[model samples]
Target chain A: MDLRDPALYAPAGHGDAAVLLALRDPATGALAFPRTPYGIGASGTPAEAAEPVELSGRATLLVCVTVHQPLSPGMQVPLVVARLRLEEGLVIDGVLEGTEEPPPGSAMQAVLVMQGERRACRFRLVGGAA
Target chain B: MSGLASMRPVRVVGIGMHPYQFPSETPYVHLGLTALRGALADAGLAWPDITFAAIGTGAIGMAAGRVMLRHLGSTGLEVVQVENASASGSSAFRTACLMVASGQHEIALALGVDKFGSAQRAANKDGVPRLTPEAEIPAVKFAMMARAWRDRFGLTREDLARVAVKNHGNAARNPYAQFRKPRTLEQVLAANPVAGDLTSLQCTPRGDGAAAAIVASEEAIRRHGLDRRRAVRVLSSVSSSEHQVADEGWSLVEMVQRSGLAALEAAGLGMAEIDIIELHDAFTIEEIVYAEALGLCPLGEGAAQLRAGQWDIGGGRCAVNPSGGLLGMGHPIGPTGIGQVTEIVRQLRGEAEGRHHPGARTALAHMIGLGSVAVGHVLQRD
Candidate 1:
């Protein structure tokens, strides 16, 4: 299956899980996710000094909300959106796999799921982890 | 950087507004010109008397200033358009203050005007792709914030509704507000849910309006014979953007705190001295969180303050959003921030007849834009 945004994540080489692509500034030890050519903004490190890295897709759910209205074009209603803290300490927002809001501090893992025609990254609660 | 206090003093001599309302067929020119004319009349200054004009707009395209100002008879004054997202008006007002304080201009105009739907976001042009585009919607982002606050601070949904209740009640008395009807907690809760716990009534309505503020130097006020008794002095102006912090969710709040403190420090005042506050309340949750962030109360105590009516117009401690705030007054993009200043000036001058905060002497106007940037200003009467 084709990925919706190949630049943001890729298959983890194990069953349906995915790994988030990120960048690490060599000098400052700072990490940025969804790797961009702009490099780490905080450290002002040039792209040349940044190394490619992959987040394990494991994160702690910080907060989540259910969007009841399709506020944006092509958006479906009652979808769950969440802010997650990656294992590597980077915070990012992503779509949750279920409409139900998982409590903050719940352990979650990223997985690719069909969004219309393309596969997109969605976070799901890790079994027996909190 | 030297604050406004260290420089030559600047005062707001006049303020006017074209009442904010739902999106209509009214031309942006009409909305803008009405405000400009009202301000010129209020300040007792002609078009040529003004040395500079800062046009704050979000939707209207380039050269908005020249096109709009020429209709009032071009005076060949310096004109620059400022666009800083939601804080466009605040930035324009700041520019006008700076110009007068730096001796660049004797008198300047900060005008904010906008229409709905035409504004565009630069985030779409950036190459960054998002995992959840829906989260980019402000309502969704703030709803998540409301959820986080609720979990961390035990904030309830009713607490959020109360913000709407008070602001809508305030708006009912503000002739310039977009939402004029007062809503009860039940009405707000029963309103259409937009995202998370945010109902339609809890969010700022999409609208079109114009607001204008004329700033002048002390020399200009004397030379023009403007009423000094009504002029409110610009005490301080501070602007800053978000910095990376441990909690990404509260990054905006962090910026507000830094800028708010810097503004107070620049003015040589404390929180106890602030009599009124006009803040960005595009969402109900913003007022509560930002008030706490600005030290109106300790963290997790904003709800209690609201319940106690301490933030009301006559609640005793301080009047917040006396002109109805964004939730009720209307956030017409560029005009929202300048409108806040206009409301502050009126309150300080004892001119906000119907919605006046009694004995209001000092006021602060705080606004945040799309870049997650924050701008704050402190103003005082006499």
Candidate 2:
């Protein structure tokens, strides 16, 4: 319940990092991001000590209809923010990678995206848009 | 006398609003005072006549209600603060109505005043878990919904743009509107896109404003010899929160549908009886989506009905957002909901001049917030 406590999320070691990275749901077989509610107390245990399940990298991407990205103090541009639907039916918001903006409902595959100090799941188009 | 006859009838005897504008250096006290004074003046009553007040604010924390009271001489009237995201104002109005209906107070005041400056972060304090980055910001979440709507209903970009055009046109006639200039579909389409097909004009601007309404019991109306002809009766008021469903699309629309149904049932009326509506059209697409959800049109037919001018002023059975919705009128969060009540009251009284829907006898004022809560009110000419 103490969400702010740093000890609640601290990983044990490199082996634990893999465990955290491969976190998945046992009930529905969906991949879960570490620190999320399901990933933390999944087994009725503390997040740092919870057992992690392996998950495949595949996912279905729901293409974004529109995007808003503020580049600087006064400038903003259209960006791609897609919804990734994992095989377990868990969907998440993630950034889409490509040179061109894909049409809405285009298929996408899950990938890792780096955001300075953080890394989260992102998606890339499965095939080029028609 | 309809389904509302059973309960002690509460009437909106007065309504007032502070012109919405961009966040300024002006203090909250001044803004609150302006609206409170305006409402008191409109009601033709003094502050002492108000037995209770419910103040609605989303972001102004720490004694938000008392701060406004302190400016008005602190008459020892009971004051309660309400926070329900964008629905804060309507929720506050409902509280005041309940006070009068319960016989706890003869005269009650509901005031919504809010300011969102550059430093403010748009956070929902109601503790709805932010599952993803898109869900954190309102635009992205609504954008996704808009995209899904487009995909499901085959709504074109122009169909969405028309909503902005119509609302802006309605706003132009409203002197109290924040954005009075009418917009064209081409101009709306050319505007900077926010999420999906939503352009800047399609989204409500976060501004600062205050709106106030006075609800009086029938006894108080008779005691003050108030003009009953102009008083708008509160037929029904209902509020509902969103269910934690996995599908975001149904979260908002479904909430509105359920709450609106309850309101209509309480009023002993159906959607067909509604002549005017002031809804929380936070986005252009929301107007279409909510129209369907509220039974203005059959499901998935909001866009087509809109194109047919069913929602336009004087064009169909019901005129939607004749005061220009949040899309065109400017949404100052807490004040927005109370402002809807003001518009509905005015419409029911036939005071909405240029934008008045002919023979407007019944009206609905609705608002929904980020907590995924929806509030609906049915109002009728008294």
Top-lDDT candidate index = 1
Tell me chain A's TM-score in each of the predictions. Answer: 0.95, 0.51
Estimate, for each residue in B109-196, the C-alpha lDDT of model 1 and write its tens digit: 9999999989989999888777777878899999999998999999999999999999999999999999899999999999999999
DockQ of each: 0.79, 0.27
Minimum summed lDDT over a 10-residue window in model 2 chain B is located at B124-133
Q: Candidate 2 docking category?
A: acceptable
Cα lDDT of model 1 by residue, A1-130, tens digit: 8999999999998978999998899777888876778888768887778999988999999999989988987888789999999988888998998788888899999999998999989998987545
Report clash pairs, candidate 2: A66-B196
Residue lDDT tens for model 2, B1-382 = 1234466999999999888877787777777778889888888888899989999988788678887787778789999999888899999999999899878999999999888853244554433243244544667766777777877789888998999999999989987788889998899999987777888888888788899999999899999988899888999888888764463246677888888888898898999999988888888888988888999888889899889988999999899999899988889887898999888888888787898888889988888887588888899995
lDDT of 2 at B173: 92
Q: Please provide the root mean square deviation of candidate 1 (C-alpha atoms, Å).
A: 1.1
Instruction: Considering chain A alone, report the TM-score of candidate 1 relative to the true chain A.
Output: 0.95
lDDT of 1: 0.92
